[model samples]
Target: MTKADLVENVYFRTGFSKKESAEIVETVFELIKQTLEAGDKIKIAGFGNFIVKQKATRRGRNPQTGEEIEISSRKILTFKPSQVLKNAINEGAN
Candidate 1:
């Protein structure tokens, strides 16, 4: 579901105003982004973990020109799902 869908569900469950729920969802997303930008890992039990990984500089070839270029190092965000979540998905296939 999208953020808006989440906000609507939360508002209905908590008896919160639509605006308040929207703000809460926005705040949570902002914090998640800020934490990731800071190179920290976030883990939620039964959900998944978000990690920032560093990639070393490497040489890459340009597809069009076939010219070799040095690719700069960068940080990439990755998610690893929890075992519980993985199992749940797998179980549904049976």
Candidate 2:
């Protein structure tokens, strides 16, 4: 679901004001971003872990012009689901 949907659900479940719910959601996102920027990881029980990974520079081709180009190295964020979450989804899909 979208961010707004999540905010609404939280507000209803906790009886929090819309403003407070929005702030809570935004704060969570900001903390996640800050942690990633600091090259750290976040793990939540029964959910997942957010990790930062380094990518090496590589050669790539320009799709349109068919020209070779050097792709610069960069850091990327990745998420690995917890076993509990994986099992929950798998059970729901059956």
- Could you tell me which 10 consecutive residues in candidate 2 have the lowest summed lDDT? 28-37
Residue 4's C-alpha lDDT in candidate 1?
86
Best by TM-score: 2
Q: What's model 2's overall lDDT?
A: 0.96
**Residue range 1-94, candidate 2, lDDT tens digits:** 9999989998999999999999999999999899899999999999999999999999999999999999999998899999999999999999
Error of 1 at 18 (Å): 0.7
Q: lDDT tens string, model 1, 15-94?
A: 99999999999999999999999999999999999999999999999999999999999999999999999999999999
What does each candidate score in C-alpha RMSD?
1.2, 1.1
TM for every model, in the order presented, reads 0.91, 0.92
TM-score of 2: 0.92
Cα deviation at 51, candidate 1, in Å, is 0.5
